[model samples]
Target: KTAVRVSCGEEHTAVLTKGGAVFTFGSGRYGQLGHNSSQDELRPRLVAELWGAKVTEIACGRFHTLVRTDSMKVYSFGRNDQQQLGRGEDSPPSVPLPVPLQQLCATSGLVIENIFAGGDSSFATCVHKKDLCRRLKNDETPPSVENMVDTWISGCDSKLLKKIKKEIHETFSSASCMNRSFLSQSKDKHFQTSPDYPGLDFSLAQSVFKKLLKKEVLSTEVQAAVVQLLPALDGNPVGVEGLRVFLVLNELLHVIQKLKKQPNTRLAEEVAAAVQKLSPENLQIIDSKVTDVYKRDFFHHLFLRIVSDKPEMFMFNDSETLVWFSSEASEENVVNFYLFGVLCGLALYNNSIVHMSFPLVLFKKLLDVEPTLEDMIEFSEAVGGSLKYILDYEDDDLEDQDFTFKIHWDGMDVDLDPQDPQKAVTSQNKKQFIDAYVNYAFNTSVEKVFQEFQRGFFQVCDQRLLKLFHPHELQGMLVGEAVYDWEVLRQ
Candidate 1:
């Protein structure tokens, strides 16, 4: 909650958190506080009206306040007698409201780039989307993945395909070329690249690979460049932005395995080996589980609530203690989990552990080792204990216990035996129940988000070294030492 930006009016003050939340205080006589009141506030109070909007910039006029969201929409509050709010409303004189952008403005492709407030007026700068896109396109060197994909889809004659193949070699074969590729240019986020945030557009990377796969020639050339160049990437990259090459490459592997019905095993192996050789100088790691099990408690407390507290985006275990991403997490929220994974990768690459409260099964999954019943026990004591009891039961008639394939978890009734919804759990198939539950807990239920988290994680880490670690050891390495007992050493 530490303030990152602050702005002061004549009497009122505005504070912005690192998470982009805003707080206001000092005075509220003109509703500058955005609390729908004109009462003065002695202490800084959260601006509830702007909650979840993620304000990136704030400006204060003599009697008004303006904020620009990450989405670039502007919000204003306080005195608007001079029409400084730009709300175009005739409602109450003092109100917290978004600037009313006309429908034509959107259709005209006007993009808001900056905001300012001073004296008794508010102002915002706009750029034509077409011109902006043209400038960005011109800035791209070595031809972006989007440009390459678009050109291939436009039509692939022999001459163009040959040119494309050569371009692929020139682009991917050079570490500098690949390093400069796939950066997310929105809001200049790429300039802020860190291990915790690779600033690469993973969706763009994966999609580009998908398109490349369609044209056998382009995909093959890409495979060759990856096999040759990625393994030779600079371990100590020039800047954090250079780290994006690993992410873009890892995403290529993900697309090959997940999307290809007939994947090339040799290509997959070569690409995987290249990614596995990645040992970056800095490190990190998960969802709520990923954030929760940080090696250090400080990071755990600091980051856990950022994602875990968003109940609408994540579902908790029955105990409401552990976090599993909600299947219904909004598409935007799901992408956040991916970035969360990148940060986790940052922690891992730097040889630092974070507060990732995930069960041991997560580490097992990272190593590509399947989760087992014991992993289930470690994840959920009650469920795993009962499953163990059922396995140990001498009674031949487990049917007498009246267990069914239908089980509830994270507020959903999942059918383990979808083929036969009436399938009963008997002694003969009790193991299947355990397997299904474990899979549902660690895999099926949260597949999309976890996959994104995994992709984000491997963006910086090589799984070969991770695979060498046992689940328990990996867990300890990520979340710090769990066994605090010193008596063994004393003995």
Candidate 2:
């Protein structure tokens, strides 16, 4: 005998003999026994109707029953509440009936893959012969098949049809009649209702359904409601909360796009103001702790826009923010990054006068150490090398200017009368200062200091920018050349 244990909230066991006989034991609250009446049979009871047909599988819902025949037909009984029995009603069946599921099966000539019965619902998967063949051809596990003959038989019964339809309407209408106050009052009620069975909160589900129905009943009215709610979406924590930030960002982008086309002056002004109020710096600080991809995308777009429009804001900030932005700016976040980059480029160019002191200070700090000199030289060389490629390109403006020159350094800390500051400070001068400073303090060769500079520049500058520096100039300084090669230097 092949025995199967079943669980319908609690445990029960059923056994099937090789000769096709079936027996069951356990909880029987409804007529789930397939033998009539609500009886809790503790011992295995032979199911008489299933005597001739070979029982292949048995499934138990909270208060319903399902049995599969060897020929792939299925039989069901007990509770039909929620149309879970696939028989279309909320009443319990007194006897086991064959279910009519032939239409579902005839659509694809497939057998049943499996059957799953939840507390108030049942689902089945059918595996078509062609699909199975394809799986087998690909060395995949082909789904075992069973025909849903039971569903078709049960559905064909006139009495069952009326019961199913009436039950559905009653369950829906009764749920609709119960308002929030009524539900709250019935919260402690012990009797199991069809819609609220298993004690799940159906308030949200009911609301969603009513909203859907309302939308169908009055399309124009619902559209006006949507328009009214559109402005409030930003404030709707329940509506927008727990949603991916990416979705919000996408919606924001769509709004921006639409504004570009239609030009909603008031909405545009409001959105722009809202964006400005929501500072990117604050958003970045908040985004760092978040691991959600959608939220990250949202914050990423916001951060990019802020930085691009106000590059000066990020110029003096820590590199962590830049790294974070770079990491999150994928194809999904590209629009944000592209807009941001454009903004940053424009900001950098437009605000040159105001930012002159800052970049100069950054450059000075970088050259202050012996290692910084090597890094700067390497960076400059990379920049020069990339310029070489551009200079070689056809129809380019760069070819009109002198492309090569040598940079010389007389000494460090030249006493300029502040009014007579030199045109520019060279890498050699910076290196000399770093060597002298380190030697006087730590007694180490400037080479070690130069190495540190290389690491620092790579850390600070974007990889694309670093690749633009000339390498020959860097190599000349490293080899102790008094005058570094500037053949490729821009005049």
Cα lDDT computed for each candidate against the true fold: 0.72, 0.41
lDDT of 1 by residue, 102-183 (tens): 3446887798777889889988888898887788789855556688678876656656777777778888888677756777
lDDT of 1 at 235: 51
lDDT of 2 by residue, 357-377 (tens): 122212323334223333322
TM-score of 2: 0.26
Against the hidden true structure, what lDDT does model 1 obtain? Answer: 0.72
The clash count for each model shown is 29, 40
What RMSD does each model have against the real structure? 22.6, 22.7
TM-score of each: 0.40, 0.26
- Total clashes, candidate 1? 29
lDDT for position 413 in model 1: 87
